[model samples]
Target: MKPVNKNDRLLVHVEDLTHDGAGVAKVEGYPLFIHGALPGEDVHIHVLKTLKSYGFAKLLEIENASPFRVEAPCPVFDTCGGCQIQHLSYEGQMTFKRKLVRDAITRIGKLPDVPVHPVKGMENPWRYRNKSQIPFGMEDGRVVAGFYQPRSHQIADTDICIIQTPEADSIMAGIKHKLTEMGIEPYEEETHRGQLRHVVVRKARATGEIMVVLVTKKKKFPQAAEALKLIQELVPETVSIVQNVNPEKTNVIFGDETITLWGKDVIEDQIGDVRFEISARSFYQINPEQTEVLYGQALEYANLTGNETVIDAYCGIGTISLFLAQRAKFVMGVEIVPPAIEDAKRNAELNGLSNTLFEAGPAEQVIPRWYKEGKKADVLVVDPPRKGCDEQLLQTILKQRPERVVYVSCNPATLARDLRILEDGGYRTQEVQPVDMFPQSTHCEAVAWLQLAE
Candidate 1:
């Protein structure tokens, strides 16, 4: 077989999609990932790089187009790294995400018989994100705020983003303009010597409340009062304006110090009937509409009859715990972040929920201790991070043998792997439901239901 070289122009038939939404084409069984290509399309690609087993290419021309292809509406779609698969139609995205879950369970988990449901998609997928974290940088001696370029830290200057809420876009643009007029320097990552690093915006969909967080390189925000005045006048609905200082050089968005520049420190939002108070660093779900759907599926899987105790692992701000408490005899939540635990307790008190307990500690350590203290769980619910559940936590769950295990996951591969471990530990995989939490992007969320072997 002739080895493909860089800068080689080749015509290939696109066959499948990678996990990140790039199209796959093969030359003699050597897979070449092409950006912006889709399945069932014949495309001309310029080979960018080649490896021993696979290659990377750039889409040059579409000789044939798939019926599922659509015109991407975002002007910066090609450069911004915020989203992928926007060129594919929403219906096609749903089908692809559903297949993603199914393929992972069948191939990774080795559970071909486990039922995976069709993806629950949004009625309108665009402008669904309630949160936006735009990096601030200087381009051509002017302040710019937008997403980074694909796989790179270079900011793609954008005035608008379709996935983010309209209020967030307006507020971000207003602050960027005001700060630029005030001669505020955007953070220089290479030198770490500038003032502003990022601007994060969060909008509550139900309440129309907004929060604007300015991440700075130092504790002192230059022209703080004037900047806050401009932001408030521009976006009057904004209820919170915060400043977070990070003196150290790092890529992380938030720092240890957060101070309210104006208004309240926290903003209120709701998922279904439960209310939550969100702070600067709270791990609230970005998409509120689909969070209701995802959690609703989890609630359905629990099948609580108000007489069983439930344990919520990795419960951030008591969002899932509060939901479970409404229908269970008692609910206990465990989290690793202390601030998030405080927020959880505050939220529980705000909702007047007395049947719940929130503790700050690692679930792997805390849940086992609860079991030792004679606190049993009839249902176990976990909404873990993208890395999925910890091994020790999985072992603890298996040892406790909760009658029902409701696993909420953001990564299908890890979820499948963990499910296989649980299945081997005497649990039966019942069903999986995929939800499009981050629409117009490649990320997919799923809730899995499992039961102890009969």
Candidate 2:
């Protein structure tokens, strides 16, 4: 019989944290997940819902708070779904992330002996994000813009987001106010009857260049000129103002056509010594400073001596390929997105790099063909999506037999699973380094180095 019921108020002790940053407390071995609660704390809670084996609870009161708990800085921390662990101290966040990685590697991968190092955290974690994609909606006949409410499409209206750069906040405020003043209706998802859909702002930290992308339901934005002028006046760092038309009635933020309403089509940004031309759709890392650190760790794992070949699989815009090309004999990068490959080629040319080649195809298919055509890689680096590397790619890595492998991951459970596959395929994981790319949030990026066994 279940020990908890709906509307049951009970005192429980939080024992651990879930991957989504929810506190886990067991009532007679039946786990209950509570938000706004941390591990090692006693809290009074009301059961909201119950399932076959688990339940969800609302934190009524923290009878005994953990030392790591701190006041969340953001006003909408509870309602906004952007950040999950804002109430936890930064120090506690780092420790939790490290344990998050360690536990995944140990439990999921079943590799208990693997060395999981401490997370490399930022000194000032606030306002570190360079890109912001905020959705706009109407509430009470006023245009509202901010992050979506938790698990819903409702926009939590706010002018400031502490994680995004100040320029993004300013640009969003200006655009929102201008849209209201210009009688532009915010796009309604249910009816699909409005004009503006979303506003994606990218601010280059290295160079104070900013790109403002106005996503609308159609291309006939008659007030594009005024919107551009307002953004330019609001922030002097504005370099590009573009309009992306998404006529579909779907949840996707962008659509097929992009028109440069004003300014340049692409803005310039730098990471390490490599400069990149970021467009409205480029997949540049949101956190540039930590990106350098993550890429640097991958570069170090490669241990290039300018006499070996490297293959960067799932390469987006040649970020890691360009980083490795500076030291390797040659580097070949492949991605499934053709436009990303074009951007990669453009970025390579922009950086005056000639030894790197990027192709538009799946890493699994392209790499095996490369191996068959006498183009084998000495080092293979993969930075895959949250689902981790494809099984075909893992098989390709084993067949190619690279001397070293550097796996950069944004999801730990998938990383652990992939690492186990590589370990069984004759590669020994040297170490895994966790990098806190998104602080005050549960997300963490890790880079693992592996060597082929003799």
Residue 183, candidate 1: how far off, in angstroms?
Answer: 2.4
- Tens-place lDDT digits, model 2, residues 31-139: 9999989999999999999999999999999999999999999998888989999999999999999999999999888889989999999999999999999999899
Candidate 2, after superposition: displacement of residue 319 in Å? 0.3
Q: How many clashing pairs does model 2 include?
A: 0
Instruction: Quantify how close model 2 is to the true structure by its C-alpha RMSD in Å.
Output: 0.8
lDDT score, candidate 2: 0.94
The clash count for each model shown is 0, 0
Model 1, TM vs. native: 0.98
Give me the displacement of residue 413 in model 2, in angstroms: 0.3
